[model samples]
Target chain A: MATLAAVIASTHHPFYYKASTAPPEERPPFADEWVAKITAFRETLTRARADVLVMVGSDHFHQLWLDNMPQFLVGKAPFYDANWYNEEREFGLPRMLLRGHEELSSHILRGGLDEGFDLAFSNELRIDHSITCPIITLRPEADLPIVPIYTNIFAPPLPRPARFVELGHAIRRLIDTWPSDLRVAVIGTGHLSLELGGPRQFGPHGPDPEFDRKAVEWIASGDIERALAEVTLDSLWTPGNATHGFMDFMLMMGVAGEGAKADYADSLDLFHTMEAYFTWYPNGVPA
Target chain B: MSKYLLNKFLFTVDRDPDLVERYRSAPHETVAWWESTIANEILNCHGGEASTWLTFDDVEREALAGHDYVKLFELGAHPFLTLTLFIAMFERDYEEPLAFQKEYAARLSHFSLPYPDIAT
Candidate 1:
């Protein structure tokens, strides 16, 4: 029987790539530190050698727009590859990953909506940085097969956070029903903060490190529901814009389950504009 | 004469205090920006009163800028409004057009105004 090996979520800040390849002097202030941390996280994923990766991330208006936005969309591609470029123009994800996306996509949509959530479906779509960046950083070779899941939390009328927790369970149910012998991993990508456009353009990045630390500590302690309840909408939106990615944590916790132990967890403040946290679920089943 | 009539007409319609504040602060400048942008040439234009004759270009620009076209039209006291305009024009007559809109309004009401009067 197929089992979920891990659930991972990270902040998807485009500048990470910009900082990675830039020369030391030319790089953004904390570029070197961020690159090192990202590299280490990637190493963990590669070492795990998890077979199938289920990627959950938000779509910028890049492919789908408000005119035809779907709350939850699953990619039905046989293979998926993203051609992403960095500031130094270095390319990533040289090859595509073979995937069991069709089954995963169908099952997730059916299960999610049956559970009272509206999910969008798509086969003809390009993978965006939200899904691409973390995948490439972790699996530079793109050797593992990927199943992409898109959440519309970035857009309005988003699924309630509690509902997102339910979506996580729906994904678990979908994966359990699959007939293949696949060892699956789940990933959620977005931000831990919300510094947008111009405000983020200036440097020497100062983020609300204290708040970020508190949020991560809650996740590590496995008190997600309490942590979520304690976090107010204003706290997430103001100060440093960390509220946008709270749902990512909720979705991840749902997949990780109450009993699953976290193998790794850390939050890194990057480029003032972006803050990221990552975690891995070692036990496949929900605890 | 046209400016005075337009101003009077605007004052007559029921306007949300929040929207009224945004309009007083930036409506004219925003309209000017839309007029010069490509969308104004495509969406708001119609063969009507010279002052009321907005092209599709105008409508497109307003939509792109994240403004409510229907509300803008009602607030601006235009001669004719688009179907999108009906959304705000008949707020009492209809529920919100999209689920996202309702959630956004609820979540970000500080930034949003009450729905515009629809009877106009």
Candidate 2:
């Protein structure tokens, strides 16, 4: 059986790559502080010593369109080209090619279908910043083979928060039961309260700081029940138009398990959205 | 309401650098050409399989032609798509980072909770 090395969830802010890498003269004032927090967060994964990563992220209508959108999809290929032209034009993200772990990808796809998820499979997926932001933040080397799982957080008629949680639980179950000697770490990214292309966008803080506060508490404490109780499809709009991305955080909570507190949790309030990072060790802390 | 077509305009143009520039330089002509040529072409499918019923209505066409994001929001076009494409076309005009985005928000400040439905 595979060892679930670490369960990590975070907010994938696209600007982090540019903000952290810009020369001092060109860097934003918040760059140093943001870089420091990300550095410490990166260590959590480093210490886990994961052999492979199961990356969960939402596509921002880059490839998947309303014409054909899937609720949950798994990428089963030997390689995935990351970032899009729009991402480069907007966020200055580097184009990347990530190796795929086809063995585990097949395991999860088969197990997931038997477990009742009509998981969509894509052969050639050009991923956007949702997956790459984490790769940039957590593993700059981008050397590990990954099994990319995309949840439709962008398209409407999206799965409810509860459904996301269920998918997370299923993923955790499948990874734990996979017949393999490799250690796997699962990382997913989401937002707290975001308002993209709306009246409240690019503010000094997230569109709704109050919601961010409670959301961080729910995630860090692994309070799945509380988070699920408060979050609903309709209610998500109140925080910010894009706050539905919070459902991904709920999914990560399900992966971490109910009432299983995080080993490390931290958040930074950036303009437009709150940046959050959390890590959990299911098989105890690695040496 | 052909909200889908409105978003299709934004999505298709946003991805193509040539279309982004074309739309920016000549919104009226670009929207007209797209509606006639590209609007009905089924993405990821062959040209022979193009759909005939995906044309935009007057208001939706005008919104795209005029670059009226305010009207696009009211019509329930996906905000993210609208913003990203708009930023690509207009952000370069601003002196400060996110100035164009902030101005974009200000343009839609009248809208409150329960935003227009973006469901396709």
Candidate 3:
């Protein structure tokens, strides 16, 4: 059976790309610092020798719509051709081919259904910043085969916070049962808070660091009960609508298995949002 | 009206990068195209049980009114679209645009039209 090597949760806001072009002082002080942090993070992945990565992200009305939006969708394509337009492309995002692990993806889809998850499955799905940005930032090489899972965080009728945790646990069960030698890693891409298109979409004021700090502390504490009790939808969006993406973070907690502690956590608060990163080792840190 | 045409408009703009660029570069023209080609078709038919043909011209006129974001939101336009249009149309003066859009969201948050029952 394949081993669950690592579980990482990181922020995926367009501001990372937007800030890359801005003057140094205009961008967050920590923005430039991620190059080093991401490089080190990548080193951990390389050390783990992970072959397949399961990425959990949310769509921004890009590929899905309110007409027929799915609460949870899984990408089952053979490859992902990221379609980046002018502005997104200008942010130094390269158009590249990302490999997709079809067999594992199929297993996950089956497992989700068998486990009674009404998941939306697509064989052809477009990659957006939510899935691409983090990979581009952290795993710049873009070599690993991946399976992308998208949740409906933008539209209404969102799945309960607990539902996301269940999905993660289901994924863990599938990985545990798979009869393969592949070393798999799971990534949850989202953020602390920062509204987009809402009234607070653009601003000079920074994200609520107090909210972010508590989130970090909760995730790092390995106390799922406390995390669940505290990080409700109301509390998550205390900063703004975009903070709802923290459901992705909760999903990662479930993927990290029972007692995953934060191997590392970085809170990078940009001008308008908190682009945070957290890594947890499911099988405990390698001595 | 189904009160979801505005939702469709925002979804279209968000999905199509070229359309977003068009709206950003030429707001009046983009809005005109959407009004004539897109919104007209969607808003013309009464979406309720009764077979009533909506007056598309009146809807278009209301949409064309200058800075009519709040009016549209009140008329069943989704808050996401209204705020997006506000920012896209006037983001050059960033802070003010944010304030304007925020006020619109604040107002809509009180009313229950587009986002009915969707706990935010």
Better of 1 and 2 by lDDT: 2
lDDT of each: 0.55, 0.94, 0.69
Tens-place lDDT per residue, model 3, A4-32, is: 88888888765565555567767656666
Comparing 1 and 3 by DockQ, which wins?
Answer: 3
Candidate 1, superposed: residue stretches over 4 Å from native? A23-25, A81-100, A198-207, A232-235, A239-242, A259-261, A284-287, B1-120
lDDT by residue for model 1 over B50-74, one digit each (tens)? 3434333444334323445333433
Instruction: List the candidate numbers ranked by TM-score, top first.
Output: 2, 3, 1
Off by over 4 Å in 2: none
Ranking by DockQ: 2, 3, 1
Enumerate clash totals for all models, in the order shown. Answer: 26, 0, 1
Ten residues in a row with the worst lDDT in model 1 chain A? A84-93
lDDT at residue B98 of model 1 (Cα atoms): 33
lDDT of 1 at A187: 82
Interface RMSD of each: 17.0, 0.6, 6.5
